[model samples]
Target: MTGKERLIELLKLLYAVTDEDHQLSTAEIVTHFAGQGVPTDRSTVKADIDVLNNCGIEILATKGTQIRYYFSDRQFELAELKLLVDAVESSKFITAKKSDVLVKKLMTLAGENSAKELERHLYTAGRIKPENESIFYAVDIIHRAINSERQIAFVYFEYATTKSFVPKHDGEPYIFSPYAMLYNEDKYYVLGYSEQHEKIVTFRVDRMKAPDILDKCIVPRPENFDPVNYTVNIFSMYDGEPYNVTLLCKNELMNYVIDRFGDDVRTEITDEEHFTATVEVSVSQTFFAWVFQFAGGIQITGPAIVKEQFRKMLEEAHN
Candidate 1:
């Protein structure tokens, strides 16, 4: 194989080996590289390892009778790495130029075959418009806060008031330890602890502004806190008391509901054209609004108060 091809193959082998174990012995490395059509000489393998290490591939070697080399650290989990690839293919908010750069970097890490496959799929994926700059900036800050274990102060825009607040602004500047960024219903949310409320809260990233990093760091997140389950149970990031909701949906919208809430939800086919589905999800104004999207096609059927609220919303909409 050509020198460049050999080098690429060697790098791919190293990545695979490092993923399983933190290190690989010289014999193991030679055997793996040799399978890639690369004649593995001791000096040549050492040179390749040096190049990879210098290029920030995280290779570390121990010098002894039988030297061992391996990746020292990994920046992304396997799932996260796959998600990044998918994001590049499906990116709507990132510019094409930026996407290309990101894809190229991912390709270098993914190896040529995986990179090419991702590229092919990306070509067919839908593209979205650039996201609001405020949301993007907030996400960056939130990620930094989570990584550094630092507290953040930010002006939060209250949707109800249509106003902004800083630390001493009309509303309070919340101090929180950021946990994770969650994507729900095409929007992004930052899940964190709200010191002011002494509870975990999810803030719409777009609504956060003027974030200030605090000097103090936060305690490590609780091991039991599962962000995914937490967000799902809370009905897409709004943390509120749980409620059981039953809705009558037209058959046309049944597929949509099933796609979202899954078939395991208690669903009854009513007549030829309607289906009734019931789910116990968190009750939040946001969740209420989501339910309202189906309008005439879906009707709330349970919890006298929730049903009344839905009716009231319809009444308000008409008047």
Candidate 2:
């Protein structure tokens, strides 16, 4: 074999068989290289390692009665890679087949041993995943439009009685100036300015298809627009104007409040047993349903108009 071939084989050996928790001694490396038809002595193996280190491979070595070497740094640590793998496996935006492919790629960032650990911990049973394969393409095109400052056009779809998606608005082409992408409720959405309505709106990216970047430039994002506040108010991606709502809640449900509204909610002790919190939320039927399901544990106590609206919604539902 050529000199370059032997050196390449040695480098592959170090990367494949060594990790932070697992190290290969000089003797073991020589044995493995020999088995691979690249026979080398201890001195030659040491020289090869030095050459690799000089070339910036970042191989770490330990010396004592026994000498061992390991690849200390990787693109991502084992723990970080494992976390990414878990996200891919658990995400609902990615399809089942795509999740497997993504998790497999994430595992390769670490060594073979670390990959086995990630594989063993993977649990992807009975989890719902999106059926739209073109969603990825839609995301790519949206990103390109955002970068190029151009408009995009696509046909939106909705679920039908036959358990399949049917195009909305009689298969009309919707045009938008995409401002940003958001992940909420484990789904992806694109916040954009709708040209047809001449207002800021959001569309489910996974439900969008045949996205094409138009020649016209995009409309600038509103100067007063706040993406963080927008995401916070868009509960369950329901469309409604935002309201600074106050809710009187039982103190025991503090965890529930934090889980839903996060830690930024303004809270005041109403009594020893209850508290009041003022939160900005998108007032919609979905938000109303969420509050109704909580029963008397939570009650809207302020904004006389909102209170009346909630009452009317309940009364209509009853009749």
Candidate 3:
């Protein structure tokens, strides 16, 4: 075979067979090539390996007698590959089918023998994967729309009682100007201005079906909009009027406060046992439910309207 063709096949063979733990002798490399009807010898094989190394493939040889060759410095280390596999397996938005496909592709980047090592650790098709296959493609379309400053249209869906997806508002597509994609609570959401709502809103990217970028342009995003603050303010991406609600929190729960509202949250140490923090949050049942879960360690201390809303919710629950 031609020299170019031989190197092409050699590279594939090396990637498939040799890693740090597995090595092929020059004779073995020639034998495999001969089996495929290519002519080569030890001298020629050594020269080809030199050329591969010059071309930036990290092929290394043994030092003493009984020399064998292996590939080193792979694009991804085994541990790094494992970490990526873990992310793919754990992501709820990726469907089990697509997750399986993606993990296998990642395995190919690891050499054949090392790929088996990765296979021992993970699989994508398990534990709370989305049923919507279109989610995978929708994220890409939304990104393109954001990059081009364009609008997009898609049918948003909610899970039915039977766990199947049902489109909202009789399957009418929601036209939107996507400004940012946000990740919260292990889910991805697009934050944008909605034509129908006439306000900024968020939609779960995974629940979007058949998303398409329109020739229409997006509305200019609010000049002062701070996406980080927006994500911090909205509890679970639920909608509500914003309120600078103050909370009396136990001093021990400082980490929890920072985790929810970030370290920059305004706070004053009220005494040895309590600190009062004023944080902007979207006031809704979800937000109150979050406070309720802390079991009185966190409580609304100000903004009488929000306090009354919390009281009404508790009273209604009591009734």
Candidate 4:
């Protein structure tokens, strides 16, 4: 067989063995490959193993068995596997039947034991409601636009409406260069550069419809454009000016804040019960809305204007 075909067969055998068990002896692997119509020898198998390991397949040799190889920790983590299943279940792009089929295929690759555990976790903790099919279609088009560096036009709605094609009150087409998709609260938001506004903007994926790709390519991303910091600073999916905001969070909320903000957070313990944290982010309606959700546990400590606004909102809500 051709060298490429031989390589494919060797890799397939490796995958099959790894899927069944985390470890396999070199003798086992060689025998397995030989059964698949490939001649296997110690030197040849050793070379193939080296090639696979260099290609990022984690194959570890155990102490007792010079021949045994096992997947490294990087191959799969229980948490990451669970998250993958969760993402698939929550995706709107694929139909239920299609998702089931895909999950089954993934399970085959992961092997039965891992597959069962993944299924258990998914069924217990994972819950997702299906979104409109059109949203999925639009998102697919937007992804293509982003990858191809093209502009896109789409109809977007701010609120729900039953009437179809109401020309005047319906939506207008908007053109933009797609930047990225942000997932928050189990919904997808698209960040893009708006041609009309000459600025960056975010649109809810569900509201977008009938996307058309344009010939124009995206301008180069700014030298300072950082996806992680940009998303965090915006506080929401929408792009805007950023501000450094300080918050007084009770110890109860310390873990929550750290989990949300990660190492980017600057924190100091004020007392046994309270901690002060600072986050550099945009002051947006969404930011305030999030603060409101953590009302009793978190208090805005700086940016007096935002603090006052938040106080007024609380007062108004109580009134």
lDDT for each candidate structure? 0.72, 0.84, 0.87, 0.71
- Tens digit per residue, CA lDDT, model 1, 201-227: 787766677777888897567779888
lDDT of 4: 0.71
Candidate 4 lDDT, 61-153, residue by residue in tens: 775736676554345565776777776766655556656766776665564446676673344244554534566677788888888988888
Given candidate 4, what's the lDDT at residue 200? 74
Query: Clashes in model 4: which pairs?
Result: 26-67
In the range 37-131, model 2's lDDT, one tens digit per residue, is 87688898888888888998889988878899998758898788878888887887788788888888877778887788788446667668777
Candidate 3, 210-309: lDDT as tens digits: 8899999999989998877788777442789888889999999999889878879899999999999998888999889989989999999879999999
Off by over 4 Å in 1: 1-86, 93-97, 109-141, 147-149, 157-173, 196-199, 206-226, 237-241, 268-274, 284-289
Per-candidate TM equals 0.58, 0.92, 0.89, 0.67
Candidate maximizing lDDT: 3
lDDT measured at residue 84 in model 3 versus the true structure, 0 to 100: 90
Clashes of each: 1, 0, 0, 1
lDDT of 2: 0.84
Q: What TM-score does structure 4 among the candidates reach? A: 0.67
